[model samples]
Target: MPAGKSQYRKGEYPTFEDYSIYAQRVVLNGEFVQHSHDFDEIVLILSGTGEHLVGQRVYSLKRGDVFVIKGETRHGFRGAENLELVNVMYDPRILLSGEGDLRAVAGFAYLFLVQPAIAQQEEYPYAVFLDEDATETASTLCGFLIRQLEDCAGQYQVAVQYGFKTLAAYLANHYRTREDLSEKLGIFTRAVQYLQYNAARPIKLQEVAEAAAVSQRHLERVFFEVCGLSPMAYLLELRLRHASLLLRGTSKTVAEIAGECGFEDPSYFARVFKRKYGAPPNQCRNAKAL
Candidate 1:
């Protein structure tokens, strides 16, 4: 079968070489094929209700319900009528660095790495029920990310990264901890945090969803409902913006700059840069020199 039409087989959801982090809004009308990916995912119900099958267990889902799917976990959605949600996909390491190790960051450890581990041992999929306050805060952050992704000018990468960090900090400070996972932060907040901390590194959507303790569909819905762009669009905007700055402010060669900006191909980076900025990389450098 063609990609995305039926269930995704293992390794079927290809991770892009140059980019990581992806979110998209999904409108489910009927049953979807069972599929699995190589990355983590988070799903949040925006409207309507459905049954989500993750591995062997099934969970009844409705508005404000969030589900997290580990990489390579077989899952699908069923019994739906106008079921809408956002999917946030990313890698897990996005939130951890030298000082940001998972063990060091209590929130990161609890939601992303720890919860899934426990859920796996217990043979249950991880999920949560977001309260109204948490829901609104999450919706606002998702909206902010979408806006920055769609703006298409200025230092959007910086903006998106900042937004992600703000979202993360908000969740870390406000959301419940592992001991009291009963009251949790909004799914969108966790996702934004993951994006903010890990955007500069090589990461993906599955990781982001896992970190936020949600399903990919849930992440995408808030991003679209609030900002009107997909997660990848936002990530691309970040890479190009950084590349443009390097072109204007540094003497680094285009190839070197592309690698620094997380692009595997310098030529492709140049094409994307020109498309977004209306000028070639050399022009930006030359203009700065003059």
Candidate 2:
């Protein structure tokens, strides 16, 4: 937080530290030179639609969508007509480690914590306006994080830190970590939430319908349209996906993972696992492929 005098006019000097949170309206056709930041980015689309160009790929974002740009993910946006958003950037360390500066981890964080997929040729998933409960909670958390960072109130640092944990958890839960077919890649965020929460259950089309408050037929039509998969098939794939995550992230036995992922028969679970992942339970667990 260093203060410096501006080149023009009346005596004026300001330190970035004096400003805890930075909020502004980024108008369309605005050219923001490519820049990188040490803190994380939480971008909330207030209205209209826009495209985020990170390198060559263009991510179409719509109103009510909130995107988390982890660290130095080399991102900038172009707003469409009538576009508005709240872009929150805060010292990532303040929200994560709480007490110290992340001078040491800045570079590494940029690679893993910030843009984990950039080098791997993967694109960060876009969390469009979907799922009322999750998106609303995220928006509230983001608002507070930005406020506390901008204000630097008493103990706001600690509060901001905790708020980030909530934000991170929500991101991981709401967005699927995959390419090709992904829940995170869809527009109906509520359906994704329902699929995530009830992935292991014997999912019914009507239930998916009810959870999203859309009729089964309507849900199927749009789910297929946006996701390229039927609602029920999407649910099955999600179960397998959760199981796949457990396969690598934990030491859960096949049977435990099977039941945990809603499959009653371990034998049947192994069959589905092999079919979906091209490997049996033991091999998958051994290889630790998620």
Candidate 3:
């Protein structure tokens, strides 16, 4: 692809308004152009070969190649023969915000989250390549998802959500079973999974590192490389996110919500919550109510 910059926005697409998800299949004979978007994308290579340009690195692409593009990460494809792929574009904040269980799946965090974070890093290895059977299965699921998205009829929204989640879970499980997963990536994935599973309880860096079978220093380095946050910081982020959702969606009191979210002190929770959200817990809740 030529060296240039372009951007795609979610609001520019019709399907984004209803469910914040869109699917499209494309065939590229030449270059697809270097561009970034405001939403995340899951790319599934259905057939043929190409060169995928991510940031400053270029990687070979082929059938069954699966990877994620985080929002605003400049990338493109070139040197294509018959590059065919399916792009599932979505707003993760909308599709995955409340799906804690799905995030806890064995390889979900690695494939969707850690991969994207480390894509441009030197340690970035390769995209997840599905075998022939898994590729066919994934393609079928994508076809059904695309059809539902195009139909856009009554109750189709729910069906589309279910279909996407099913595909995501399938891919994650496949990643979990892959024998080629890098050791560093595995450690990061395990650490993240442990953090997500135990976010509602008070957790220490030592606990997270032990869960990943790595030392605290190594764990911190991996977390910084993949998430740009320390382990404790990431846990706090998870806790605060949960607290925000509860404050908006439930009738729980501030102190109760604080404890449930793993904050031992209501006053500390309120102080930090205000620092993060720019309002006290009660005020934030009331604002959401109005």
Candidate 4:
């Protein structure tokens, strides 16, 4: 570990009881020591220039640069010249679990999942650079999100969640239109989106590769290198996550949820669910009920 690497806990930040979104604007004149946090962060550079060190890689930062830093990734900034940025830290497990519609957008998966996953492996992680107009718009959205967090008025949580989602969707949509996205990354993003769209059905590695116009072997290698999981394992995780959401939010039977989440056998689903969540579906649902 690097010297001065600090750990930032989510509990240390002010967040709503029901929502975990936190936003703050930071201005740095000198070095910010290396640190890792317990929540995902969306960084939007507002002004000036700096050097960002992520893991063992260093990248230059400037105005309009946007990227994500996943939880527990050690990163810091140095050689700062009035570097200004908005850091939107969030708990994806709480925010993304219920937003199935966002998953339908391929850019969402690419921006939040694929880009962060490949950052350590690739020379430069993919980032979306906003133009002057878009930068202004994003700054306004971040300001609104920060105000919502501060005010704590009635229905403020709702506004905060919606505000975060709006910022996320706007960035994802912008990324989708960028001409600089590499062909290989495009293939990977397509494969992830296909899996997201078809996770409720029985699918195979070959099918996923075909959807992405790549060979099964190649796809497996890419998934492992970028996502740290085999394609099949990733799909299983998606299915289980969906099943967990259904278990908590719906009155569906375990068998129904199992089937709906692409588990062909209820017994097998129960075993896998127990292994992953440390509880069977019914027990999980009952606990949620109470």
Best by TM-score: 4
lDDT (10s digit) by residue, model 2, range 199-263 = 56677777667766767787778766665788777767767866766675468799999998889
lDDT of 3 by residue, 1-290 (tens): 45435888788877887877889998877777889987789999998888988887787887888888887688898887788999999876543544435776777777876677667665566567788898899999999999998998545777888888888888887742234667766788898878877876789899899999999999999878767889899888878877876786578899999998899999999999888888888998742322
TM per model? 0.50, 0.46, 0.77, 0.78
Query: Candidate 1, residues 200-240: lDDT per residue as tens digits?
Result: 66778778778867777876776565346565676676577
Q: Which ten residues in a row have the lowest lDDT in candidate 4?
A: 92-101
Question: Cα RMSDs of all predictions?
Answer: 15.1, 13.7, 4.8, 4.6
Between candidates 2 and 3, the lDDT winner: 3
Report how far off residue 196 is in candidate 4 (Å).
2.7
Write down the TM-score for model 3.
0.77
Q: Show the colliding residue pairs in model 3.
A: none
Model 3 misplaced regions, further than 4 Å: 1-5, 94-100, 176-179, 215-218, 221-229, 236-290
Pairs that collide, model 2: 20-149, 20-150, 21-149, 21-150, 71-114, 131-190
Which residue pairs come into collision in candidate 4? none
Clashes of each: 31, 6, 0, 0
Assess candidate 4 and give its TM-score to the true structure. 0.78
Tens digits of per-residue lDDT, candidate 4, 75-154, equal 88888888999999987655455543677664777787777765655365465578878888999999998888878744
lDDT (0-100) at residue 63 of candidate 4? Answer: 77
Backbone clash tally (model 3):
0
